[model samples]
Target: MNTPSQLLPPPPRPLLLLILDGFGERKERENNAVHLAHTPNLDSLFARYPSTLLGASGPDVGLPTGQIGNSEVGHLTIGAGRVMHTDICRIDQAITNGSFANSPVLQNLLHQAHNVHRELHIFGLVSDGKVHSALEHLFFLIERAASQAVAVVVHAFLDGRDVPPKSALKYIQALENKLEGKGRIGSISGRYYAMDRDHRWQRIHQAYQAIVHGQGMRFPTAIQGIKASYDTGKTDEFVEPFVVGTYQGVQAEGIGFHFNFRPDRARQLTEALAIQPFNRFPRTPLEHPPFPHYACMTTYDASFGLPIVFPKENPTDIFPEVIARHGLQQLRCAETEKYAHVTYFFNGGREKHFEREERILIPSPTGISTYDQQPAMSAPLIADAVIHAIESDRYDFILANFANPDMVGHTGILQAAIAAVESVDQAIGSIVNAAQAKNGAVIITSDHGNCELMLDAETGQPHTAHTLNPVPFLYIPIPTSHPLPPFRTGGKLCDIAPTLLTILGIEQPPIMTGLSLFVSS
Candidate 1:
């Protein structure tokens, strides 16, 4: 380690903090973005100071669920000025134990939301794949809401993006289980909505079908009408439903994998027969037949979409804006529009059940732009936001996420990551140019590392999946009338917040961990 430098006075300037997501690290290949980009501006930032990688641990990153490190932890640490270690699983456990208030970090969040009426709306990965939304996090949030008398509304963004498609109800059920019987905590009361329809009513497997279908014969769910649905057009296909597994090889036992939801529920309701199975199934047979099981049951609104904030996005779809204005009166992660992806957000196609994007591998010469999903480019809108933030006098931090890099990288899109990185570089050049005109101190860094720098474990080739490694942080000089920054920020995730507070002329309190490298020696 370098010698501890002499102590110096902190900079007395407003900081322009920019946290880039899924940036940093690159393989040695000649075609990757980090290796190919003509980034003199980035190189110059490197020459200006001491820097190190931020170990963006997916779990440590404090997502409500999941193993990937995304924005939830990155920004919260930067904003809260400390690492509270509020992992999603821990939050889940706390909810189970009814000890959430004991977690000072969560308590602070809820308390703060209560104080600001600043709606604490959580937008995250809703999956038991546990990518982001954990069963416990939602449970505790409800308990906290009920305790503080804060009205709660959940806008669940489904994650067939990571886990199995039909499994959405599993995580949802876990949340429901906790919320059950205990008044309104985690119940079906608050404005509950889901955004991913592709996973809405996914196909279930044989074993799962067996268990859930067994329950269906006894439950007999309430629906307007019901009818037998099968490919009875062909006489051979008209065989009894139990033979569905034999023909389809799905073990079509129980009220299991039915094609439609209305009939599926009708199959699930064992009791709707006026009384017997509904009443007797509950009391009569604990052992005579298979035990009752739930296939997929969740009470979520058909509405909810990612809140959009670009010219392209329909702002009226923002459910949080509605809740804060009319209901609970608080907000979290609410910003006008700085999302790295779509600039203009709408929820129209949210509920359509579609297959997950099939992961494909492309050799070095291939590119994603040449394949499907030109992947909606929010660049123009994001570029506009970056420029506006640079121009704004009160803006202290501007975070812009360029997703194709890391996202495409997950599909092993090497060339695509490189292109994505180049795009990011261009975005940076524009933002810096704008900042220079306004004389703001610009601080740029990425949350975790992915894309251009994949080291495959099997082939040792640059792999596609996210890797655990240190990512590069490029700090450009803010064109302030003041002198240049002597050194750049250092340490790790813990250090980012302190560095910003230093440049902002704010005193770094003890609660605010991480050392500020911007102070002069």
Candidate 2:
């Protein structure tokens, strides 16, 4: 084998570096980045070259699908050049395999538990949706905490938006099983406690029964998931109507809190927003050919089974037969490259309705163009933030988060999200322009992916609203005079800072889990 000195490449040309938020995603002709509107600069970039599906295969897809990439790991690899999983998984594996005993953050937490007789609170999502936080890893953390003689108080952020409704029971059972009996391999000798919005859901279900009972639905039978419509048993076909409103409802107001739709009809809106990846649902027996009405939806502990709204928008005046004739043409007849999605939900009859064909409604138009928004900050805010960073001569690296595509997409409001993406595209131009001025290289990429999806191939409708796509890894080169490290490509997020140090001729401590993208040892 060749020695370390002979293996690495020479340093790169001197240059500045830029990282565009969510810039690593791709553009597509159908239902993709092109959906946004007025992205002149981004359009040119796409026209000149082809974009690839980034991090398509690997451990990043749920179990590192070896198919998709996520943000944390992607950035780690891009910055460091060589790494696996992310901080979450890395910490978890250390604990699982017994190496985390030495990690300072973990070690401190563990030892502190022994000294303080109080309980430790573990607050996070409680689902395998793994989009943000992972449940399996959380369990390991809980196990480790208990092993150190610490009483645990877990406040689980139930992920009804991701997993199925009322599925908290599954995770609860799992945790309960893990914490069963002390003195096990886990190391601690104390019992752990778990509780989530106690006595809340029961009252809501009761309220629904009471409200629907008056309408002659016969107790609005309780059930979850798809059961043929003919099946009398009630199914939890859910959607979350309000974001802060719903989350607030569960916290301030107890269960059985009722909201009225009709003057005398106090019906239960299953204000349960399904986690995306399944936003465009079963081909409904509706009127119009389906169009993406909303892209994002959220569900909370109290909002479960509350019939909020599916599409969460008003119905169209046109009929389905008319819409069907123009639906496919509408999908393909786009002239402009930039498109945007906007879905709005109102407090009325239903969040959405299946039109004549298959389209769903997100919300009324009022929500999209509220005069309250800042034209100055519309899309330029992203760029301004980056430029401000450079002007201030702050840190060499800036990791900022722009939430248009990811946040809005979850609402299933394809149109609105498209608009947000257009804004982001404009922002990308600003940052890239700044970096180019400084002889910088912009390595744009994403953590995980969204907005680049279709219905699961077999289902033929819409896939679950999820960031399952493989994002892009783009490198915008810049000419420079300062000494630079050799460029290392196809790395993870953990590698970025280390790589930056390497590129700038700075030294990185071995404690860091990242490697230099420019030079590798």
Candidate 3:
């Protein structure tokens, strides 16, 4: 039996790590967007190089058991090269142990609201999905607030990307049932309106108008609005803003509490909401003063300006400086939506730019309300950027992410998702060709899976969430002079950092829990 070992190889030429966001492998080829996509380049690479599956979900990636892996958890594990508890796990523990219920932040906010005679408005996702805010946690908070005779209102954003598409009504109704006497559902909107990261002001403006100004498409009930959204052919996540009757009647006065832990999906909306007295509607500025009495679940991005009482520690602090100590020049690029994942989460939640590291951001094409309309989202530009950076020989390492398959796959549009995968494949081909020209090795893998399993096995409907499926990891060596060894087995995301460090002739950090995948005979 072969045991896991830490062995370093001599540093070779330049190397690149390409992360394909939301790309996963599936057994059933039918309805598999990746398999359906025309990915000749990826196929050729898989055949030519050693490839293996990578575990990216649940405990394998440091998430709680049974919890599906997300971009945040996956990237953090890959960057830290260790198994660390994810944000969801932290939240889960807090709620389970009554820490969240009795948290000083919650108590102070509620006390401040009660003393000021202000209504406490809670805004967050209404799903039980762990990626976003959990309904149970929200309910527990509401229950505790109501116990103190504090009137509370909720602005629930529908989440179709993390849950089943078009299932917003089910969650909305369930929430309403729970809040029948304790609280009220003030507004209903899609995550798209409340969670654009690329500074999309229009969506934020619409959500602001609905929640604060009480001016938008008014719906008698959340279910009715969700039904209308389906009739209008909009996915649950992209549905237009709809204000519940109670919200229009009662102003968005008093202390507002935002409950999203992960900020990437909701960074822009949070930024817009921080602006006090938002009157310009669609013309809100990107940067503004923080909203009064507003607090977020975590302070992942301190610059966003929301007062956070429970901030998670950055895992990079525990990570050894392997790449930086080696004096490797690293260049990274990705579209706006995933720029943070490649930099922030991929650096184990570090915000500070590392020395000798360069990052390039390509603005995601705007004007399209939904990603499915423009399935090929900026992959070509990112690919071009990576190719230029690789061939420039200015950097010893290149890291890039193609955000198409993940962004488009969230729409659950079968053909569009396939096209997105194809676009990524073409980008990979360009990168591979560029690496060949520069005599550089390339590591291709994914953060998690979303496009591979296109349908729900039980319901036979389109499933728009990340899966527990394993991701593909392929490594192509430079020089192409010697035959590569057989691929190892049971690779996980954490193994990536150690493997890359080993290839660069750096000592494997003891903090890394994953073993290197490179095995020699």
What are the models' TM-scores?
0.48, 0.45, 0.93
Please, what are the lDDT tens digits per residue for candidate 2 over residues 269-329?
2221122222232212222211111111122222233222111222222111122232311
Candidates in order have lDDT scores of: 0.39, 0.37, 0.79
Q: Is 1 or 3 the stronger prediction by TM-score?
A: 3
Q: Which ten residues in a row have the lowest lDDT in candidate 2?
A: 186-195
Instruction: Order candidates by lDDT, high to low.
Output: 3, 1, 2
Q: For candidate 1, give the lDDT of residue 174.
A: 59
Q: How accurate is candidate 3 locally (lDDT)?
A: 0.79
TM-score, candidate number 2 = 0.45
Return the top candidate by lDDT.
3
Model 3, 239-276: lDDT tens per residue? 88889865763333347788877867656666556645
lDDT of 2: 0.37
| lDDT (10s digit) by residue, model 1, range 1-521 | 22112232333222445555566665565435566656666666666644556656554454433365544345444444445454444445545676655555445555655665533433233444343345444555566656775543332333433343223445545544554543221111000112211221111111122222322111121010011211232111111112111111111111110111111122222121112233322422333222221121111222211111110112121222222232221111112212312111111112221121111111121232221134223444455666764564544344345554555554444555555666666666786778767755566676666554544554444454344555665445454343444444335565665665454444556655556655454
